[model samples]
Each structure stands twice: as structure tokens, then as C-alpha cells.
Target: MATVDRVEIEQAQKLWQPQPGWLNTASYGLPPEPAWTAVQDALADWRVGRTSWEGWGEATERSRAAFANLVGVPVADVATGAVVSQLLAPVAAALPPGATVVAPEVEFTSNLFPWLVQAERGVRVRTVPLAKLVDAIDAGTDLVAFSLVQSADGAVAPYDEIVAAARAHGALVAVDATQACGWLPFDAARADVVVVGAYKWLMAPRGTAFAYLAPDLRDRLRPDAAGWYAGEDPHASYYGPPLRLAADARRFDISPAWFSWVGTAPALDLLAEIGVPAVHEHNVALANRFLAGLGRPPGDSAIVAVEVPGARERLERAGVRAAVRAGRVRASFHVYSTSDDVDLALNALTG
Candidate 1:
């Protein structure tokens, strides 16, 4: 649990050059210089046919290992994919007939739809208020799924309580870390399945995602989207034959989008170097500063939902970038965000 010092945070901050008014990281992140450069280099190679596909594929492994390290999991337990829903598909498919899942009522559709779609097979999904999520898990609950941080409002889940409840009920735990990963320090290994769509918080390209499947959970899931990429040896697995897949979570991998991985590798590597605890401290401080300016109490989350009248249009007019979610102005802070960014948003809304 090494924490990064100010020097390290300053060094990491130099890697990105986000515009001063940028506050919409919850929607998408601006890539760090290394990641942007890596993607550009890979795209150049693709344009000229200067390198073989094998070279591009190497980035996928790099990204997978980096994501595993970021989440405190072994690489063997990690699976790579292009989106959160795609990665969760097999987990959803693994549900037993008549199984029940408990989730937050406002969960992003990517996590909710997969389980809800199982209704035709007798699997039931129960959605409750975020505050009631832990208490709602019962003996009949087969699994509990939720996001580490809510996308619309930046509410952090009660991770320990939910996990304890799930364990008490002999229920499996699944978490989507899309909005929390790089800025929130938590043990992803505590969950049976952890999925991340890296584009938003990890500052990577949109096509990059990762999942960690605990060994027992991995055993239960079928690699429904397994392709040559999921093979024990991808190059050798091309063309039909007696099926051979990796013995680990890689068996769930989908064929990666090459340029996306090229960018993802460097971005994740940078985040790992800076340490999530450092990022969390920096981001939450900025968020609190903004909240204070707006005459609101400090919050634990880096994303703030400002409900002031005409907030979104004010931010837009002031050249501040933020999202409108659930009728509030959603402004998120990340490692690249500065106090200036927060001030800009505050001025827009308070002026």
C-alpha cells in the first residue's frame, strides 16, 4: 500500500494537458501524452503496413497485465474486452435457472441489462435503492452486482458492507469499476468478478476494457465470445478444429482492438506508477474545493452533481465541459484536473 508523494503526483500531472475548463471525465477522459503518442504511432504503422499484427497484439498483454496490477489481481485472472457489457455477458450467461440477482436500481444499463435479459430463463433481477443494496441481499440471492461508483451522481457503494452481506448469504459479488478504477483505491480481488470499461477513468481509448474473474467464478463461466484470441496459443488456434482455450480467465477474452490496446497500455502503466491512492486524494480534494465554492458540504467522491438551476447551460456558456446527468450538472475530477478546473466550474454555476 505505497502512497505516492507530491513529487510523483506532479510528475504524473505533466503527462496530460487537458484544457483548463475540462471537468467531464465521467463521460470520457483525455489521454495522457504517452497514450496518445502510442496510439498515433500504432496507427502510423497500420497505415504503412510497417509492422506485423503480432507487434500490435503485444499491447493487449501489456494492458491486461497493467490493469491486473492496478486492481491488485494476478494477470492470469484478468480478461480483456472492448466494453463492459461484452465482458459481463459470460457472467450473466452463467446464472443458474431461477437464480436471483440484487443490484442498485440506477445501475448503468451495461451491468443491469445483461442480468435483466435472463428473465426469459427464470433468472430474476431485483433492483433496490443504493442505500438499501446491502440490506436487500438475502439467502435466495444468487449474486449481487453493482458499480463501485455511481455514474450519474458519483455516489460510492458501501463496498465492505455489500461484500459482507453477499458472503453472508453465499452469494457471488460482481462490480463494475468503470467510473472509479483509476481514482479509487480498492481491492478489486475482494469481488468474485470485477469489470472495468477503461475509457472514462483510466484515460484510455474507448475500445479498451478489462475484467478480473476469481478462480471459482471463472470455472462457472463459459467463454461464450471466445475467439482465436482466447486460444491457448492465438496464432495456432486460427481456423476451426478441436477447441483449445486458455486454462485461465483469458479464455473469456474477445479479439482486442489493436490501436486501443496500444493506447491503453501506456495509460494504465502511468496510473499504476502514480498509484490510485494518490489519484484519489488529488481528485477528491479538487471535488471538495468545488463543492465548498458552491456552499455544499464535502463529499467522498470525485464527481459532484450540482443541482443549481441552469447549471449545465451556465457551464457550457462559460466554456466549461461537464455532463448533465439525472437533471444535475455532473462535474468529475481526475488526476489531470487542477484547482483551476474546479474554480472554472464553480464560477460558471455560481456567477
Candidate 2:
């Protein structure tokens, strides 16, 4: 049994400014007051110089530890970054030359392009229909990259089964959790790699992301373009022989957007406080309300898509904010959303 504290959730909402009919957290999440305050505190520390240097380093590691806890992984396994694309490019480069990569055609481009671009290195990126994805992986498959939750229609991938299949074939698994992480819970233990951009459902500022690499997989990867920060001695004053890489996922790390890391640490801390299981419960309850209002069934993820004519104009005229994609009105829900937000979006579509 699991539970979310009502009083705590309401109290948490106070940290966020009220926004009417904003149901697009799947696009970009709004950071709460604490995150902004964290930025100010971080700025103040930097202005003070030497005395605050250790604090800056602590904040960065705090963010890594926070994200690790969020995804149920060890802190050493996680590495922060600027965005999903940048975090994933190295994972793509790590694959053996001429390996075959399988993915969904309708996935978010960040997850798709990195692998597709690998073709230039003799790696083949094959776009498989979702229905055929599990069956597509074989002995020759080097890696299977896909989203835990689809962004457009909010389709949740059957990853456990897929992971089992990929493992059976000795192929690696990498999951893009940008649309899934904070809102839904999954087992990252089964994955070789998990990547997420903090700006989306995690509710952190943009220019922040993290990747989790299983310890064994870390040895297999060769970061195509690592910087000085990616080294074991990131702050080392002098370079020497045997240019050292980090022992864990930090080998894939980059110079994080410092301010973004400041905000992200607090955002992740908030989620950890609320508990992901609780957030998932709240989001699913809101999704149910939105779906019932629209006469649709319980959806796979917090996102519910409906077909409506002139959908964009109607939603705008009614002051409802949602994404119109591929001729479907995609409404996404988060902890901050309420029943009224769902009703308002539904009324605009039905009215």
C-alpha cells in the first residue's frame, strides 16, 4: 500500500504560482519558489569566492545523489549534463562499430537522432513500429533505445518485457525517461542506461539532465567527446600521462549549467520529499478525471490525447493550454493540476 499526504501536497502547491489551465508539464515543468531561491543562494555563494567553493562542488554532487535516489540507482552511477541530447550522444558513440540499433519511429527526436546519426560510423539505426519493437531485437542487435513513455500520445513502453528480451539476446538497453521519470515509477535496474532531461517532468530548470549507467556498462562505453570536467581530476591544474576518465558514469559528464544545477538540486529534493509513488498516484488520479471528462478510457501515462477539429483555436479561445500534435489535442497532467484544470480543458474541447 502507498499514500500521498494531502496537506503536504497542498503546502507544496503554495511554492508554485497559480497558472490557469496550464496542463503541459510534459512540454516543460514550472519550477517552484524554492528552486528560484536556490539560484539566488548559489549566486551569492559564487560572489563570495574561496569560502564558498566547496559548497558549489557539494551542490553538484547533491544534485547527482538526488537524481540517483529519484531513479533508485546509486549516486556514483549518475552523471549530470546540459540536456538529453548531449547526454545521449556519448551513449550512441559508445556502441561497437557497425552495431545495429532499434528504436520507434514516433519517438522524440532527442532519442532518435543520436542513434540515427551513428550510421555515419557504420552503425545502423532501424526504425521499428511499436507493435514490432520487442520482436525486432535479435543477436545482431547491439542496442535498443526508446522512451519509457512516448511524448506525443503518451504511450508507456512495455520496458520490463523489452529489457528481458534484449537481455536474452545479449543486447544493451537504453531508456529516455524525460517524459516518464518524475510522474511514473519504473525499474531502472534492468536498464544498461537511463537518460533524462531535468527541464520536463522532473520540474527542474532547462539546461540540466542526468544519465545512469550500470557499472558494467561504464566499462563498455567510450565517450566520443569528453571535456576536462569529464576527467577523474576535473579540477586538476596540470595534465599528465594516461588522461584519466571517471570511474563511473561521470566519465560521460560535462560542465553542467551551474545555475541550472542549483535549481535542479532543490527540484529533485522536492520530488524526493513528495515521493515518486505518491506523485504517480496524484497524476494518475488527475489523468482519470481528464479522461472521464473527455469520455476516454484510462490512459497509459499522464498524457491524454483527443481528436478535435480546430483544436488549437478552440483550446486557445477557451484559455486552455495544451499541445496540438499530429491533429490530436494532447493534455498532460502533473501534481499541480486539479480537477478544474481537466474540466476546463475538456469543456473547451467539447463546447
Candidate 3:
């Protein structure tokens, strides 16, 4: 297991001052001061036309580089977009007719819908329990797509096992890391494609998303959503004609939502500096504390699903923000969460 410095965690914690009862990072992360300030500044600039859009656009590259660093991939392999489905569109479009996709039955729609929509093209999407996901990938499977951490139950995927299985069967691996990327340390390069929504664990504005495309996968897909942003030189491509796209994964890029990227760049940079190992250590510790308080077995994930009666009402009454998913109250801990936040949710449930 990787170890992180307590000092680093402490310094990272100082970047955010979320309210005492924010346990809903699984739904959306509360941005740190820098991210919020960046967004605010960008909005102000937009309102007055005080600065050139070029300055705002620069943030997209910073965000792309930061996300690449966080996922342990080359910057050239990363592409920016507005959402997971948008990022995954090219991958979905690349599937051949009669191809089979295996995914969890309860997967969040962003990861599942794109594949399912391909039914008209003879693209078959097979749904199974998440625990059976690896076993479901076989000779017939063309692709295996799943979330790194389940949104409803907070179950961590068995990543290595799935990757090995996909490799053995020659199936492409597409991962949605929206719920896990910021705090979960894993190599995005292991998969054919990895898409992430920056709003949840990455603590960025909702419109920003990213994808990592392996060299082979990048070559396989068409840049279906290409625009000026996907060009070899965006400013030069503004007028038209030759259609010179980027030679790398940037060819798949969607024009970024500028203010969102401005907010995202600092958030991702902060997470990269703090390191996922440290964030994971802090977040999981708090999650385990909450689980223990509920008299439940400790879990390795930073998100916990509480099934006790009135869990949602109790947390709401106590001003502890959380979400009810699949009939259970989901509470997620992150870099800013502490023992006090866990205790507050515990008291709300048990008191």
C-alpha cells in the first residue's frame, strides 16, 4: 500500500472549508476555494468582456495536463469534453455491428446508455450484477464498460481482475471513473479508454469531463464530434476547409466549456499535488469511521450505503447532505471530510 504524508493531507484540507456535514461527494464534490474563485473570476470577466477568450481557453490545457498527471497517462492521450457520454460517444460509435458490450445492470446511465442506444446497429449490451462483471466477459464480449466505484452502493470494482479478463478475451475496456478518479489511485492507461466527469470526485464544475484513449483505441475511433477544438491548430482551423485534425487523442476533443475548465484546472492541480494516495487514506478512514459507528463492517471505499430506516430524513434533519440511491442513503467522504462529519451523520442516524 502506498503511504502519504500527514502534513500533505493537512495542507490539502486547508484548501477547502466545506460545511460540517457534507457527505455527498459521490453525487458532486464541493469545490475548493481556488476552484470557486477561478469560476467566479471567469464569470465576471465574461459578463464584462474584460479579457480575451484566449486566456480562458488556456485553462483547458492546464486541466487536460493535470488530469493526465492524475490518471498516470500522457497528456497527448487525454481529450477534454463536457460530459462522460460525450466523451464516450466516439468509443460507442466505433463498435462494429453485432458487437457485444458487458456492463453492470445498475450502472449509471452515462456509461450504459451510449452502448445500449446502439441496439439498432446490432450492438448487444448485456447487463449483469457488478460482482459478475468479470465473469461475464468471455469470447463473445467485444467490450466491457463499468464504473470504477458504483454510485448507488459504493462498491469498488475489482479492476485488475477485470482488466486481466478483458485481455484474455480480447475485449476492449472502457471505464467510467466519475465516482473514483480524484481519490482512488489507479492507472488509466491499463484500459482502452477511461472517461471521467469532473464534478463528482475531482471537485470541479459539472460541465468539465475527460477521457484517456490508448494509442490503439485512439486510432480505431472516428472523431465524430470534431470541431475547431479538435484541430491541429484550433485558431488556424476557425475558418474551414482542409480539416487538419490533431494527430493524437486531441482529435476527439469537444470544445471545452471555458469557465468550467477554468474551475477544473485548479481543482485537478490541487488533487494532483495532494496525491490520490493521501486523499484515499483520509477519505477511507472517515468512511470506515462512519461504518463502524453504524455497527456495520468497515469498507474500503470512501462512500458508504446506509440502509437503516429513515436514513435520508435523519441526515437531512441534521443538515448532513447525502443522497438516497437504490433505496439506501449514500454518504461519501472526501479530502475535506473529517471524523466530525462522520460523527454527525452517525448521530443523525442513531440518535
Candidate 4:
């Protein structure tokens, strides 16, 4: 009896095969070996016209059920999409005109763009200051959308607190958790709506994302955008009369690429098998190692500030491909990032 649950961990590690010099997992890494091979095997069957989406579809359903179980939610509430944008577009479309959306400065474009466009239409877009973002929500704030962990600075905001504050003011909370998955423990129990990208921390490919819709708010949310796939009847091709959408978050989903769904199903299955808590612990151990490697000096050191003199140039010269934002350089971490990757990144930063 392996009390540590190393059974799934071993299977996942063998399944998600990584390439050489692959420190860029935060960019996009393969899913664990077992799941990757399983997905590919399933895809091969689909491509050869041997097996249909039935097994994959059933697997997809099981994956979501497992995901919901991992997040402490009901199976019926989760929905899959080709990307987080598709799942969130419904929430964006359903927003009242001119409503204010509060977001942090460190968030990704996927979380910001959907709400920012509303500014031109009378929706007040407020970028909350880094320190006060948690306490900034008020009665007038229509919604507060942000990333659980900042992709730019690696600074994780107080997500639970932000949700509580925004909800107290009657504002909806939307979390873009692309960087948080596999790295952080995500319990969607308190979040009104949260989207996760499978490519990054989740160890899946691009165009595969999932959304968790808080059960209580499902009815209140209207799908401003809908398609045949979004309807309750997937086989409903008559198109004669208006078909009612799914009762759950599935109504928010649009054209889901079944292939991508097939790919994600096993990828997530690997995670579910390894267990979210264990994966998160492994990732945090890596994050702590890399953060400790960045030995930038204090005071005038703009290591974290919006602007830093020669820091970006120096890092580039040292072989670190850095993304410059607000005059700062940031490197992200994911599960496959081992101590060697951390040391290499640190060596580059220092040299």
C-alpha cells in the first residue's frame, strides 16, 4: 500500500515526456507520458475512423467530473472549451452595459481584453493598484476579474480575499488561472467563475481550457452568445426553432474542437491520477528554488518594478529570454521545471 500515491505520479511522469533544454514548459510542455500516449492512441483511432469520439467523449465527461471532484464541485457544473476565451466570452457578453470591471495590472490579455473593450461602451474599466486590489471593490464595481498568480511578476494576489470583497459588493469574480494550474491549489468553491488553460501548468496543449461556474449563479448567467453545440441537444440539427441551451455551464461553451477535447481528457486524467495537491506541492518546490536563484540587489534594483536599467538587456545577453513589461523582465515556472532548469535560469540571470 503506497500511502503517498506514487502510483499515479510514476505513471504521469512516464507519460508526459519532455524534450531537451525544455525550461520553457511555462510556454508549452507535453502532458504526462501515460495521458499523452493515451490521448494520442485515442486520436489515432479517431483519425483512422476506427473509434469515434464516444470513448473520448465519455473520457471528456469523466475528466470534467474528476476536475470538479478535484476542485470540490459538482460534476454537472463544469464545461470544456477550445480555449478560455470561448468559455469566458459568454460571461463577457452577459455583462450589463457600462459596468465597471476591476482587474490587476499584472493580469494576462485573455483576462483583461474581454472586459477592457467594454470601456468604450460606458463600462468603466478600473485597474486596481497592486497593493490595494483586494480592498478596492465597492458597490459600484460590477465585476473584479484577475489572475490568481500574475504571469508577469509571479506575484500571487490574495484570490480568496478578492472574491469575498467583490462578492460583498455584489460584483462577480472571474479568475484567469492559466499560470496557476498545476502550480497552485485551485479550489473553485468560492470563485464565481474561473478559467484554466491546459497548456501551461496543466501540461496539456493550447486551445484546451475549462471553466468552473459556481452552481448558485448558473441560472442568473445568460448566454449572450450561443450556437448549436451550446444547446442541450447536441444532435439537434433541425435548426427550425430556437433550442434551449444546456442548464449548466455547458450553455456557455461554443464550438469545442473534439480533437482538442480528446487531447485534454487524458492530460487531465493524468493530473487527476497524480492528484492536484501533490502536483501543486511539486511545483511550489520548484518555484521556491527558482525565486531563490534570482539574486538581484535591493534598493535601486528594479527587479520587480515597472522599469529597470539594463536588467532586460543583461538578462538577454545571459541567455535568458525575458519578456519586458512595465520596464521589468519576468520568467514563469511550471511543473516540469526541475532543479536543473532553475539552476540554468539562475546562472543565466547572474552571469
RMSD (Å) of each candidate, 1 decimal: 1.6, 2.2, 1.5, 4.4
**Candidate 3 similarity to native, TM-score:** 0.97
Task: Return the TM-score for each candidate structure.
Answer: 0.97, 0.93, 0.97, 0.83
Candidate 2: give the clashing pairs.
none
Clashes of each: 0, 0, 0, 10
Model 4, 288-322: lDDT tens digits are 66555564432210012223556566656655554
Model 3 off-target regions past 4 Å?
1-4
Of 1 and 2, the candidate ahead on TM-score is 1
User: Which stretches of model 4 miss by more than 4 angstroms?
Assistant: 1-12, 236-239, 296-329
lDDT of 2 by residue, 1-351 (tens): 433365567677788874789989889998878897988888887787635455555667888998888888998889878888888887788887899999988889999888888887899988887778999999988899999998887888999889988999999999999999998998887898899998988888888888998989888678766777778878771366577877778878887677788788888898898888777877888888888777778765788778888889989998988999766888888878878888888888888
| Candidate 3 total steric clashes | 0
Of candidates 4 and 1, the better by TM-score: 1
How well does model 2 score by local distance difference test? 0.84
lDDT of 3: 0.91
Tell me the whole-model lDDT of each prediction, alpha carbons only: 0.91, 0.84, 0.91, 0.67
> In candidate 3, what are the lDDT values of residues 37-75, reduced to their tens digit?
999999998999999999889999999999998889999
